[model samples]
Target: MTHPDDDDELIQELALAGQGIALVKMEGRVFLRFEGVVDEAGLHVPYALVPAQGVLAKPSKWRKLEREARAALIAERANERARRELDEHVRAFVRELAEECEDAGLAPMDFLHTLADLQTSEPAGAIFDRIRQRLGHAVERQREEQHAERTRQSINLAEYPASFDVARRLPRRFIALLGPTNSGKTHKAMEALAKAASGVYLAPLRLLALENYERLLEVERHGKPLAVSLVTGEERRLAEGATHVASTVEMLDTRTAVDVAVIDEIQMLADRDRGAAWTAAVCGAPARTVYLVGAPEARRAIEALAERLECPLEVHVLKRKGPLAMEPGPVRKVKNLRPGDALIAFSRRDVLMWRDMVAEMGHSVATVYGNLSPEVRRAQAQRFRDGSADIVVGTDAIAMGLNMPIQRIVMTASIKFNGVEEEEIPAALARQIAGRAGRYGIHEEGLVAGYDADTHEVMRSLLKEKPVPLNTSGFAVAPTLEHLHRIAAVTGETALAKLLKRFIHNIDVPDGFFYPRITEDQNERAEWLDTLPLTVAEKFTLSLVPVTTRVASLQSAWEHWAMSLAKKKVTRLRTDDYVLHHMTLQEVEDICRLYSAYAWLGYRLPEYFPDVTLAQDMSREASSRVDSMLQDQNASARRRRPRR
Candidate 1:
C-alpha cells in the first residue's frame, strides 16, 4: 500500500512507478504496486496498488513489469530529444519546463526525478550542472538590477520630504550654528527649526532634553502641536502633544522623517560613552535640514564630515551675540560667598554643607545636584533664575541645562570624580561648567571664580580655550540599573561576578577578578548589610548564595529588605568597634576637637561614632514625608489623582 503521510507519498510513488510491477516481499507472499494513470493532458496517471499479504505473485506480473518499463523508456527518450534541440534557447525552455512541472502538480522530489531523466546521453549530474548554471546567471542579473536601484537612490541627494527650499539661497543641504560657550547657538537653532514645519532636536543629556522640551513650549507660536517629546532610559514620551521632539542622542533612530534635525552641543561627539549618537545623527539623519549647534571648535570636524557626504556645510559664526553692557574681567575669589551668587561643588555632601553654611551666613539658598529628581532641579534652577535663591550649590549637572542669569560663579573645587578615578577638570569641562554663569541675552557678562587654595589654576583652566574635540569610539556600554539592583540583592561577591559576565563591560573578564570588583561596585546594599553590625555567622549565612548563580535570588532578598526598611531611619556608621571609641577617648576627642570642617567629614570618620548621618539626623526628610502625606490627603479631598 502507498504511504499515507503526504511527505513520503511522492518518494514512494516515484519509486514504484520507476520499477513498475515491482514485487512486494512479505513474510509469506509476493506483491506488486500499480502506478502511472493518464488524464486528458496525455500525462500518465501514477498510483501504487500492493497485492494481498498472503497471495503469491502470478506469472502475469513479469509481463506487466516489462510493458510499463518500455513505456517509461519511450517517454524519457522524447523528453531528452526535446531538451537537446532547445540548447540555444535554454533560458526560455527552462522557464517553460519549470512552469509545466508546476502545472503538472508534481511533488518537489518527483519533479526533480523526471527532470533528471532528461539527460539521455549524459548523466543526472550533467543535467543538474546545466540547470544550476542557468539559474545562477538569472539570479545575478536580478541582483544587479536591485543594486543599480539602490545606487540611484543613494546618489539622488534631494532633501528629505521635498518640503524645504535648501537648494536656493542656502546652496547647501544643512546649516550649522557655531559659537563659543553660552553663545546662544542652541537658542538660534531652536528658533530656526521652530519656524520650519516639523523637526527634531537632539540634546546630549536627558536632563537637557527635558530642559529643551520645556523651553520649546514657551517659544511655541500658533496652535501648532507643541507635541514635544522626550525618550530616555525606559521611561519614554513626555511632551506627547507636540509635533516637535527634544530628545537625547540615544533615543534617536531612523524611524521618523522630520523636516529638520537640530543637534545641540555638537562637541559631545568627543564623549566616549555616547559619541556614536552624534556620529549617527551626522551620518544617518534623514532630515532635509540639519542644524549643528555648538562651539566654533567643531567647524573643521563639521566641514570634513560634510565633505565626506558630498554636501556643503553652511557655517553661522555667532560670537557673544547678546546684550553688551557688562565687562568680563579676571575674577576675584572671596573667602566668603556674596548673596545672589551660584556656588558649585562636585559632591553631594559638599553641596549640602555649602547650602547649610550659606544659609547660616544669612543667604536664602537652593541646591542642584545629580541626585535630585529632575522636577526638583528645575524648580531650584528657576528660583536661581528669578533671584529667589541667592545661591545655588550643585554638581556638574547644572553645566548643561537650565538657563540662569548670574553675575558671579563660585566654583568650590577644581577636582572631580570622572566615573572611575579622581582627576583634574579637563579644559572643556572647566569651560562648560564655568559657562553656566552668564546667560546670553540675559547677563551682560559673567564672573567665574574658584575658592580653593588652587583657585589660580582653576581660574586659568576655566578661562583657557577648549581643547580640540577628542575622538571616541562610541558610548561605553554599561550595565543597566536593574542589573545593579539585582546584584545588590545577592549575598556574595562570587554570585555578583557571574551576573557581571552577562554585562557588556565584564563579558570577557574571568570570575576571580570580575566577581569581586563588580560585587563591590554594584552590590552596595549587600555590603552595607554585612557592615551593619551583623554577626560572623549571619554574614557567612548571607554569603552562602553566590550572586552569579541567579540574579533573582539577590533581587528577592534586596526587595524584602527594601520593603522592610522603606520607612525606617537607618544610620550609616563607619567605626569598627564601639570599645575603641571608649578606649581612645582622648585620641577621638582630639580628632573631633580639630575644627577642619572638611576633615571632620573626610578623615575623622573612623574615630567618629557614626561616620555618616542617618535619615533620623535630618529633620527635613521627616518633614518632607509629612508634607507628602498631607498633599495626598488634600488631593483626595479635592477628588483629584495625586501627582506622583
Candidate 2:
C-alpha cells in the first residue's frame, strides 16, 4: 500500500504542471483541463491522464492508500466502543458502592475522590477491590458506634430515680380536678388550699400566683386574718407568721412539707419548653394532699402518674356553671361592640390598634398581652373586672388563669403566627379563650364572637369539639454534678453547654415520654456563654438562666448581670431614675424582664444580687406605668375622635 506521505508528494507534482486539475482520486483516476494560448484562435492542447486500471493493481500506491484509510476507521470505531463499555461498568460499580455505604451509615463522599481517580487510571479493578475491603471495615465501625450509643442511653436512664420511687417514701393523697374552661376547677382547688391549716398554691403564671396571694391575705381564718406569702421568679412577699404560700410552679419549694398543695394548669405538662417544671413539681412536691387543676384532657396522663405513685387518687369532674355559646355572625366594626367585650388579638401592634379603634368609638379600653409584665396584665384585668374599662383588648395571655368578668370574647383572627409558622388556634386553646367570656355569677351566658366569617366558623367548630386528650408528656433526666463530670470525661468536652447536650442525647426516656430539645435561642445564648472565662458548672448555670433571650436589650442586660454575678461582685441596680413615661411599652417590658432576671438570680445567689427588693419595686412600677399608658392613650384617642 502507498503511504499517505507519498500521495501528498504526487498531489504537489500535479499542482505544479500548470494544467487545470479537475479531480484527484486515490485509485489514480485523474481528470485534467488544458488550454492553449493563440492569436484570436483556439488550438488543440495535449492533456495528461492517469489510467484507473494501472493504479488499481495490487502494488499500486492508490490501492495502498485506500487500504490504510479503511484500517484506521475500523480501529477508531473499536476504541470508541471499548471506552463506552468501560464507562458503563464503572457507573454500575459506583452505584452499588454508594448503596452499600449508605446502608451501613458510612459516608460515600469520603471515598468519592479516590473512586474518581481510579475510574480514569488503568488497572481500576485492583483499586475497586481495595475499596470494597475498606468499606467492610467502615460498616463494622459504624455498627460498633451505634451499639455504644444505645448502651450509653440505657445507662443514663438507669441513673435517675422514677417518680414512683420518689413517691414511695411519702404518704401522699392526690385529687385531680378535671374539666374544661369555665368549670371552676381552679376555684375549687383554691378553696381546698384555703381550708388547709398549712398549704401552698402553685400557679402556672406569676399573675395567677399574685392573685391567689392577695386573696389569701384577705381571707379570714377563725375571725383573724390569714397570713399568706407570695413567691415568684421576680418577686417575693413574705407575710409575718405565714403558714400558706402562693408561688409560681417553678418556685414550688419542693423540699418543704405542707398540708395541702394546689398545682393549677396541670395540662401544661405537655408544653415542650416548660413542661419539665410541671413534671418535676407533680412528682416531687412534698405535700400530704395534692390538688391537680386543669382541663379534662390531662385526665389520662395524671391517672397513670397517680397509679404509678401508688397514691390514693380521687377525680372530680367539674361542669361549667354558665352556658357558653358562639355568636351567630361576625362583629365587623367598633359600632357593633359593647360594654364588657374583650377583643383578642395575637400581636402587640394589633392589640394596641384595636384598643385605639374601640376607644375612638367612645368606649374605655384596657390591654393585656404576653410581652406585658405580670403586674400590667393584673392591672388590666382589674380594670375590666371593676367596670372601670368598658372593654379589654388582649392576647392569649388572658386564656391561662386570669379572671376577668368579660361577657363576650371577640377574636380578631382565627390564625396566629406561632413564631415558627402560622397556625389555627387549637380546639383546647380556643375553648380556653372562649371560656373567659362569662363569669359564673355575673354573666348568665358566655358569648364568643369572631371578627370575620372564617374566624366565626372556626370558633363555632372549636367550641363544639372536645379537646384532644394528652397521650404523652415530656421528661428530662436531671443532670447531677457527677453526671456532668462523667460526660465530660467520656466525650472529652470541656464546655458545659456541649456536655449538657451530649448528656441529653444519651438519655433514654420512657415509651410515652420524650426529652425536650434546647431551643434555638437557648443554644445561641449557651454558645455565647461558652466564650466567657467561667467554669463548666457556672456556664451550665448561666445557660439555664430564666430570662427571655428573644429581646435584645434584655439579653444584653442579663449577660452583663450574669458576668457580674460570676465575678462575685455585689451588683447595684439603677432603677430609681427609670423614666417609664419616655419609654415604649416594649422597652418597659424588657426592663421588667431584666428586673425579673435579677430577682431570679438573687434567689439563687443572694450575695451577688442583693437588690431584689429594688428590682421588685421597679418591675411593679414599670408594669403599672404600661397599664396607665394604655388607658391614657385610649382617653386621648376618644377625645381626638370627631364629635357627632
Give candidate 2's TM-score: 0.75
Model 1, backbone clash pairs (residues 3+ apart or across chains), number: 20
Per residue, candidate 1 scores C-alpha lDDT tens digits across 1-644 of: 22224313432544534544333344443333322232223333232333222133343442344444533433343233333333323333344445644554433234333442341333223454665565556555544444434333332222221212332223236688987667778878888777767778888765688777776766656755466676543234555455678777756645566788898888776565455467667755657788988867677777766764566678999876443221233334332677557788888778766666566555666677764544456667776778766777778888877677766677777788887798887777776777776676666776677675476455665566556753332222233333333333332232333334333332322212111122333444445444444433233223322222223433463334333333332324333422222333222212221211212222222232132233112222322332333223323333432334
Worst 10 residues of 2 by lDDT: 36-45
Report the poorest 10 consecutive residues by lDDT, candidate 1: 589-598
Best by TM-score: 2
- Cα lDDT tens digits, model 2, 1-644, are 45645544543544523432222343233222121121111212121222111122223433545645534432333233443444454555567677887778766656544643332222345556777888888776665455447436534443243533434466898999988778888888988889999999999888889889988888898899888999987777888889899999978786678889999899988776667677767777778999999989989888876765567889999999899988889998778999989999999889989988888888888888988888788888888888889999999889986888899999999888877899998888999999998888899999999988889888998888877888554453345456666666655667766766765666455453535355556667668877777777666666766777777787787788767756766887886657888898778778878787877877767777888888888878887777777778889989877688
What is each predicted model's overall lDDT from 0 to 1? 0.51, 0.73
lDDT at position 495, candidate 1: 35
